[model samples]
Target chain A: MMLLQATGLVAGYGRPVVGPVDIALHRGEVLGLAGPNGAGKSTLLAALAGSVRCFAGSILRAPGVALSWQTQRQPAVAGIPLNGRELLALTGAAPAGLPPWLASRLEERLDRLSGGQLQFLHLWACLQAPAEVILLDEPTNNLDPDGVAALAAAIAQRAAAGAGILLVSHDERFVTATCQRQVLLKGAAES
Target chain B: MNVELLFDPLFLWPCLTGMVFALLLPLCGAYLRLRGEWLAALSYAQMAAAGGLGAMALGWPLALGGPAAAFLAAGVKNVFEEAAESVRGAAYAMLLLAGWGVAVLLAANLPLAERLGHALSDGQLYFTDQGHFFAALGALAVALPALAGLSRPLLLSHFYPDFYRARGRSARRLHLAFDLLVAGVLALATTGIGVMAAFALVFIPPLAAAPWAGSWRRALVLGGGLGVFAHLLAFALALVLDQPYGPVLALLLVALGAGSALLAQGHSRIAK
Candidate 1:
């Protein structure tokens, strides 16, 4: 089941930042996008998510496909005065599957949570959402070892449930350990 | 203080109208503050007031022209917001200035419009009739369910703006719809309560409640409760003290904001 295919994609803010490359994601598989800083890995994800301009490319998604995207380093939701539980509800994710470490503190404000806990809770919302396609940008930024492992488990579970997942992160080990397939995006200059 | 006067037929309708806005406008305010588009309240209110004046000059009803112009302003604002996030504040300022400019020119030329403008500026809520009272209720009726239904996407958009566009949906339409609802509500409010009072209801109470609230739902209720408290207090204070409703309401809200800020600061300090 090919869920998404992007051919010769070139995306950027106003100019090409990434691609002239090809990638395909299938149901029940995690595809990792890796590169150094400024490699446009995030840009490629944005292009696929339609949040950025695609100068040239055709992205074909299977009929009735929907995307759930979690962007990099969102401003701390601490300022929002919402708790983890409220965030999950708003994102349409359930707490039933939450790890016990997180489930106990769902009532606390997001700002009160440590960085890794907050990041993990945010990641869980996207992972648990009922979307055919999931796009994650730097999901491992502040996660501790436990949080990272929890994320890896959730990713696998989501994949098993038939989502086509696109993962972008600088944590090479996490990516290498988690994704079934990997794509390296050379920066626009090298590409 | 002659409390019985508040229930007098003459004052009852306007008081009821204020109560309706007190409860409803804060919901719009919370979302506006969340979206960082609080300036839209002033933009929409001023534009609607200007539009009302323009309608009066043309010998037509002010209500129709007010919302019509607000919707138009919402379109213009949409263009600016779409261009970049950085310019949202600038767009709101521009809209406010344009409305102020047009309103000044219209008032200068039309004698009748000048009087109406003063009444609108003074926020003569006491003079509001049954029609104005019902309109406030009507705005409340439309805004509540609409805000409730739009809560998910609106909340998501605030948290992760890319969520909807990634799902291949135009986040702008949701924004514009919200803007239009605010504009309509503010338009009716501006006509009843005056610009500053209307904007106050949409600004201060939510602000006062946000700091203490533990959840989004609680903040909403607290904000509404605060708005009602302020409105009734301002209404009573104005009646007893012989002050005008608009200025009194605006002052009451400012006091609330400042008091809340002080308390929140003290709490933070105590925790430290």
Candidate 2:
């Protein structure tokens, strides 16, 4: 089922940074937006998340649909007393499906965890949220091999559970293995 | 020690008032610290003082002047919040200076305003009347439940900001409402506890407990508990030492802050 549809989308900050493009996300499917640096790949995700301004075009969501966005760069959380389990709870993401690698460390403060471990926890939270649409920007950054496998399995499970996911990532192999379709941009679309 | 004075009926209202402020300040302070706008406590307090003085100068009752000016300050910051599309912290610095400047100006022009200013700055907890005790009671009644309702979304707004924007909703409105609530509480706190003492209750407890909290609930617990503890201790010490409540409260918190900082150095929250 079509969960979200954007028609003739033109998205950007104040000026156009991406699109004059089109995309739609459907339940039970994973969509990949693949492109070079500055191709507005991240901007596209921001537009969909409604963080950046949308200059033109329209995004339509089916009634009562919810979304989760995992941004490309998270704000500094160091020295904050929040732990991984509490962080997950913010998104209403439970720990039931978290891989053992991260599950064992959920009790530790987020700042105390290593980079790859922290990255995986963030991904897991968004992937596991109750939202039907998940937008992930460079979700693979800082992730190790085991973390990647866990993420792949998670994506499959969430999609099977009727989620529609749109992700922007530079990890070509991860994208090829997980996404059934890829939309590639030839040149930089951010102006 | 003048510990007996704490139970004196003449001092009953002041002690009750002090205890009520102890509860109200830290609860609101936790959210202010969470939002990184702890300065709002001082800014709102100054604006209230300025508002009260401005009312005095114009022959208006303080009750009419203080909240009205604070409401304007909250509204101004809310407008800044919308224009900037950022958190309320962005506009607080400017508001702080403006409020202070207006207060100084108004205080210089009116002798009564000047006395009130001195009373506001030097601490008036010992002199808080029955009305002030009731005001503190009313503030506690209003602020505690409101802060509880605002906690979740504010936390989520900090951790997962896109959650609101994605739904085509803005956190600015949430911020404005919170600012107005905070302004009301801070105004009452300023009038009862004096500005420095009120600011201490609002800033110190939250900062001291922030590094120790493993969860949001724990953060609030530690912060609120610390606030009440330090406040009651300060109140007793001020009475015993024949010191003004404001400086004594500020000094005790500074002592607590020094202790907290030292303790944090040896502490580790990492699980095996």
* Fnat of every candidate, listed in order: 0.71, 0.56
Error of 1 at A103 (Å): 1.6
Residue-level lDDT tens digits of model 1 in A1-191: 99999998888997889888699999999999988889899889888887788888798889998889888857546456788899988778888878899999999888878877888888888888779999999998888888888899999989999998999988889999999999988877553
TM-score of 2: 0.93
The models' CA-based lDDT, in order, is 0.86, 0.82
True contacts kept of 1: 0.71
Would candidate 2 be rated incorrect, acceptable, medium or high by CAPRI criteria? medium
Candidate that would win on lDDT: 1
User: TM-score of predicted model 1?
Assistant: 0.95
Query: What DockQ does each prediction reach against the true complex?
Result: 0.70, 0.57
Give the CA lDDT, 0 to 100, for residue B49 in model 2. 78
- The reply for model 1, stretches above 4 Å from the true place, is A76-78, A188-191, B1-3
TM-score of chain A of each: 0.95, 0.95
